[model samples]
Target: MPQNRPRRPKVLCLDDEPAVVEGITRTLRKLYDVTGCTKGTEALAVLEADPGFAVVLSDMRMPEMNGAEFLAKARELAPDATRMLLTGQTDLDAAIAAINEGQIFRFLTKPCPPPTLRGAMAAAVAQHRLVTGERVLLQKTLRGSVEVMMEVLGLVSPTYFGRTTRLRHLAADLATALGHPAVWQIEVAAMLSQLGYVVLAPEIAEKVYYGRILDQRERAEVERAWVQAAEMLAPIPRLEPILWIVRNVRRTAADMAHQPGASPDLVRAARILRVAMDFDELLADGRTSAQLAIDTLRGREGHYDEDVLDALEALRGGGQRSRVAEVPVGALAPGMILVEDLALASGMLLVARGYEVTERLLARISGYPADALATDTVRVVLPREQAEAA
Candidate 1:
């Protein structure tokens, strides 16, 4: 049996001069799979199409775009890719400027020997591996920790965490409707939005959820919960964006956009969370329908992002058309939306109404005893295609 060789890392070389690109590709072809482009825009299109390029090398003086600008855009497209600059000695200042832009991993002068160029690329590849490896590890660690925390919160306060589920679904839908990138971050932020509620008594959280006015002291405690939640997750790696969304989930989009370090994605995620959470609160307070809840939000002028509200309205309108059905717990499937809460015989809520069934949630349901549910059948809304099939 023959063993397969490890795949070579991909390298993208962009230079206005075709000869220069060819020279670099020929120098690095043995160690890497090289793609050469004669224009910065062409390279950028390639990066957008396939983000797996391990290294991006560009000349400092390109007619289409300077090396600094190209590398900076490349950083956005492939954040984990190591970037390098090849510039003439006369353009050394531009190369340094690119470094200051935080986009260049290394810059080599033109007319450089093949040995030196190859060595720099080898180091660049190694750097890419380090960055991507750390990202994967951090994501797995963060996800596992988040799941455990959510489970603990569910056990401690099922009502509050159940609300989190509804918030997550709404936020995710709003994100998709708005065409926002980083929907996962928005969803995860929504899932963890109620972490501060752990500080309050279950009854207090229940009161807040139902939109009952809180006493001054109770309000103070709620404020502390928000701070406590931020403090608890501050130390985790790669959670800054999620934390930003959580901390500002209630802030107006205009306010959040002006805050330090705010980016379009973060602001959009926070806006989506704010709308979903406030909408959910209205429903919890006995608003007759999603339309009514949204109407109330609109009446509160400037309290929410109008774009997010628009997305919410569009999504809710679509959901209203889903066909309703009653199915046994065993027949519940992903993409089905619950019309009523799933609670145990003892009145312990497992999943809240309006919550969409997910594979993960289904797995959790399977752990319940045979007679755990209060009713063998619960009402749900089937997706359009599923309803048609039935």
Candidate 2:
């Protein structure tokens, strides 16, 4: 029989007080690999030097930069590491800000019991694992669903909604450049943010996408779209988090515009998506791609992160065009098609035939010339009658 060894968890503790650090180290050293720091600066250096630490527990009121600031920086540096705030103060505003900005996994007050601290650390580690695993699965699932949803929207308004794939890629690039730990949320949000459009009539969706100013009733209807989107996605387990972010996406932007110091990650993600979606609309409105990207960066205060804007500018300057494969109209089929031009969305190609198109299979085939035969490269589905006749 083989003997089992106890698992040792790595922990980084930051506190200005030597006595407190000593006490925590003594209590946790038996089960955890503890690294203690007296200041945020030193802790950051230690974290930079050692990336193996699984959890960071920091005191709230420290000199130079407080725990929230330290945790915010830590999130960028070691996104997989769990973050927690330990504070003696009971300030509600500060607590909310810390959770929102630093994305702290747990909050603990001074004089915490050894058992309580242990429990919190355990929970934080578990959460870190859960979040990472969920993101991987979500990305895989999203790779397919996002295209389907976006194509549906494109069918409603090709000129405006056709750039969904572009907006998603832009949002992801911006989020990564800005060092957002929850970049997955930004990706999912950008992919599905316009889900509310599905509820509205095609004309309404077009009006919203084309920058047409909405009247009072239209504004109300548009606002309600978020709630409707949330309701629509509530049934799915994976979509719940995205729904939360999407519901609050607008509010996050408004908050950032008013309060610059708040939740930079959330604000940055929302801003990127907002600007990217709006830029696509601008392109739809006859503005050139380069000009649209440049104008978007220059026009607004709370529209996008400066680094993201710079990246977009670089993308434009580098002539980074989307490669879409075009299938001849004569060879069109009932499957997927990759448009080889940058005229519309770039990234994933089109799913040529879905439920709606399947129903109209005969109508589509009737329009094709008798001599025209579908090519294998074009990806087509044959109607049962056509297959039987052949």
Candidate 3:
């Protein structure tokens, strides 16, 4: 006999009958690491010592502890393990309790055929692997795509970009705190909410960023970009679902443009993105930092979500600080640092770390008083030590 075969999955079979344990062990030993336990307590101890068991089949009516109680503890100890209940008793309540409390993956009656047992065990193991693999892949793909999209958007239009990033983070945090699954979709929506902007003209982009009241023609043009963007992405198989979400985002925003009452989740995501984008604009437009948030909130009578407004207010008072700086009127220059922590009217940060000074920025700084440098603001080009030490 070969001393060893290929690594096999470990399984724990719990039953009060010695003959059943012997038969199951003899049947499965060739394919699995089978451990037979007569008592639930003994089974638990075995499981505690070696939690690699992929499938745990326990008798429904054990003496000391029932199958439900044992499987419930098993679920906590080895969360990845697939639990199955075996019973000769036809107690519907016990079966329901086993499923509800123990999270049993399968239920089998006593005198199970060897082939049936083998098939069930195999199926449970396969399902466990498939579900775990898909979850891992989904997380990896979602995270990587979101990161790449954010980077691309930042490169395309550095000025008005990153609003969604902030909003997504805030929304995700809030959703997690509330234990809401809808938050996951909201976060994804926030990440790609501005995908339609890529289809907009630079002039239109500028108007949107500057809070310049858009005329009827401009509003219609901007609204059409959402549908255009969805169409552009429809051919890409991987992006189909994302495009669907984007379409809804546009519809929600457009519906709430002149009117109100849309999906609450969409409304919340849109409002957050709207505020975040406007905040970015105010920073670029040299708006007053001190009262920008208050002003923006006041202006959202019919446009923004009131709940999102509350969240933004909480963000200000809470520790959700932005990395932007506020420079005084005089200390502004190309490559000069912004001393004040300027919160854009839309609640976005202005002077983020590593932000480069441009000619337009230099011009804006020159208009300010030379001696009136905002406390702690400086040019970006200064030595790291000097900037920090100052």
TM-scores of the candidates in the order shown: 0.83, 0.55, 0.50
**Which pairs clash inside model 2?**
324-339, 324-340, 325-340, 326-340, 334-380, 334-381
C-alpha-based local distance difference test score of model 3: 0.66
**How would you encode candidate 3's per-residue C-alpha lDDT over 1-390 as one tens digit per residue?**
687856788889999888889999998898888999999889999988877788998999978999999999998677778899989989999999999999988899988998998899899888777766775677568756776766556556654344555446555665554434345555776667666676788789767755688999989988887778667667764554444456654344656444333454455545555554454445544455625764665585765556655655565556444333444434444544332333344444443333344465456445545444333344334434445655
- Clash count for candidate 2 is 6
Q: How far out, in Å, is residue 173 in model 2?
A: 1.3
TM-score of 1: 0.83
What RMSD, rounded to one decimal, does every model reach?
Answer: 3.7, 9.8, 10.7
Question: Lowest-lDDT window of 10 residues in candidate 3?
Answer: 336-345
Model 2 stretches with alpha carbons more than 4 Å out = 1-42, 49-52, 55-161, 207-227, 234-241, 248-263, 300-307, 320-390
Candidate 1 residues 1-390, lDDT tens each? Answer: 347888999999999999998898899999899999999999999999998999999888888888899999998898789999888857656767899874688878888799999999999999999988977787677767786678667766767767877787788878887867577788889888988988887778878878899999989889998999999989987799999989887777778888877998898788778888889888886546889998999999988878888888888887544689999999999999887778999987887676677787789889988697898999998987898888
Write candidate 2's Cα lDDT for 191-215 as tens digits. Answer: 7787777677756776876677778
- Estimate every model's Cα lDDT from 0 to 1: 0.85, 0.68, 0.66
